[model samples]
Target: MVDQKTPADAAASRGRGGAPAIRERLTRRKPVEELVAETQAAEGTGLQRHMGFWQLSMIGIGATLGTGIFVVLGEAVPVAGPAVILSFVLAGLTALFSALAYAEMAGMIPASGSAYSYSYATIGEFMAWVCGWCLMLTYGVSVAAVGVGWGEYINELLHLTTGLSLPQALLAGPMEGGLVNLPAAAVVLLSMFALLGGVRESSRLNAVMVVVKVAILVMFVAIAVTAVQEGNFAPFMPMGMAGVSAAGATLFFSYIGFDSVSTASEEARNPQRDLPRAIMFSMILVTAIYCLVAFAAVGAFNWTGFADGETSLAGILTKVTGTPVWAVVFAAGAVLALASVVLVVLYSQTRILYAMSRDGLIPAAFSEVDAKGTPCINTLVTSLVIAVLAALVPLGPLADATSIGTLFAFALVNVAVLVLRRTRPDLPRAFRVPGAPVTPVLGVLACAFLMFSMSLSVWLAFLAWLAVGFAVYFGYGMRRSALERV
Candidate 1:
């Protein structure tokens, strides 16, 4: 007669006993204590922690200051008029609430999965998987969106400076009535190769590019200040509070990349101290820059003027200075800056995949690190996928989809922080969100509000994307989960 075990005994065996045990384990939550142990164990897995606070902060800035200000502003300013300045502040505050929650989670978790890891340890595997799925869409599509934005500015710069342009078929995506976005695809590949060179190299390059990005904005502001006519301030709130809120929802994408700082927790020398500082610092710095740029652009010319241009900043500079030369320079800075955004976004994407793979939720090869201590395989794989997206999809829908995914992830993270505080009060946390439940509650509400502000079409696209994610999780991820194997 075959030996049989009771269900309790089998469940007590941690899912290693048999198929029944494994299936039972699928419903089991990964305890906070176990996740902490796993994170400690991963330190010896060949990924090095070489980043400091400043480098990590630059990564946040480099990632966040790209397409939102450079491209989206062309559309956003028209919605809020001169009051777009308030939109940036409101959006920043919304992001700050979630960023604070993230800082607390990063301090305690010190893991690569960002919100996914936080949710897994505090919530359950299903929620964790959902968070990871949302993030995969957020970062992956964000990289593609930024790449396409870069391509647009580059083509615009060339047209303004040299009277030359790439063929429309090579510049636009199929959705935009073109064959493929070759320039967008090329930028994604470039960022991939840069990442393959290793983290320190990429960080240094990002730092330099960030400086260039900042300098161009400062120069534009200095010039725009001289051109400021009091007349532009007349219709400051022409669109009123509703418009400001709507523009805030649109500008929320600008703040999405600040969370990328926490994704580098596994790669930071002192994540507990550095991660929190980087998150806050990056958010504050980027917010100030955004406010200044919005003020300068709308002050220099009527906000109405910005609606007519493709590259808002560059166009503003050209109009103020009465020369195409400044616009070309601004576009060059934007191109380089947007490339850094792609680099950091792709970096976050690969690292998130690395963390998921290490958990056995995906293929193990993605977790494999190279001699240089980089997830080169994951980077290569992510590059191919994102490159295809950039080449084939239009920028507008991709940006909206990314924003919705990010808002969902942010809401989940806030809930994770609240849950962990109640469930595991004993866990050591280097940082904590002030105001406790209130702060996180606000974060949840704010993210939900922004998410709902998206168009019905965007909602449909987001739901369709999530439906596909769920199918993938059940079909592939569930069976191969490391917890099930255990």
Candidate 2:
């Protein structure tokens, strides 16, 4: 007699079908503990239970509080006037929704490489590759952008202190009438070496730099606040909604690196407990700092002055107080603080490539580990690319490109949160988005809106990069992908 199986057994034997099959495959891809184990084996125990709440918080702050406050203010104040404070809140809210969603996924997966790994386990191979590709775009260009900013600040500091500095040809980018930014390239290389040394070194370095950066920000607020003229806020919406939205788009960069905390989830001591705290705390802290800075900056300087340069904060301070000392301090803080940002962003970029390489989506060289147990080859390769870009390219186009790629990744994570909720409801989630469909939906739309607010030129360049990504994905990533083979 033929044996008959029960309904449950039958259902278990075959997948839910088509999309369900993919979802089932994704669901069974890797368990939370197993992913943690793999990450520990690769990244070493440095990231394991070694991180506590304080350390995690530092990571978030160190990564998020960089060029945004120092430089983005110049771009934003011109657009939103004193209302740039509101723009920070708007961007923070949107980032918060996505951060919560990432917290859920990060807690569930407990992986170090970040959203790339989370997408792999929740979404399919194609989407995973796309997200990884976009992450590379986000962090790599961010490194170059920060490096370029660093060069400018270093130049300013030298001029302030010694009354002498490197020639423009050696200190600035080619477009700025320089052959290359040597100081920027040197910092990128230095950061790469520091990262390759170990995460502990990286974190400690980050802690020290973060403290100095925050101190400078506090100084800006403390001094600028006292100089506030209420009249500055009179035409709060001078540029109107369009300008506010434009400012929101740029302000989003200030919150960009907050997600790096999620990337470090695999190494968290208690990701389910700590990841949520880290992500939320970091966002709230950054939002508060940025809003205060905006309030003080607008009150201290006329919005009309923003058009003079991208480094408006220091310039405004010079005008408001008529003291070069404040400008010197601000510029010095920016110079030092932006170096750490470059370090952190470059680290993230290399690791993403390392993850992709390990997964066989990219060249194996990226996966090669050195005696120090870091992806040295990958980090060096990234540093080389960033240095070259910093030496030759203008930051405006590249910065906008990074923003576009990041927005795309953020939008994907929001959608993936909803998809995973419906498809794998039984799966244990350490954290769940509070408003479910509403939050994720709004997150997607907000990211899209900001992405659209970028110039037409940025959109065109982003499209070109996406086309290149598609070429890479289809040409090699698809066939070689481990998930595809599975």
C-alpha positional error of residue 221 in candidate 1 after TM-score superposition, expressed in Å: 1.4
Q: Estimate each model's TM-score.
A: 0.94, 0.90
What RMSD, rounded to one decimal, does every model reach?
Answer: 3.7, 4.5
TM-score of 2: 0.90
C-alpha lDDT of residue 36 in model 2: 60
lDDT (10s digit) by residue, model 1, range 317-378 = 88888988888888899899899999999999998898889888889999999888898889
RMSD versus native structure for model 1: 3.7
Worst 10 residues of 2 by lDDT: 18-27
Candidate lDDT (C-alpha), each: 0.87, 0.77
Q: Give the candidate number with the greatest lDDT.
A: 1
- Give me the runs in candidate 2 sitting further than 4 Å from their true place: 1-37, 40-49
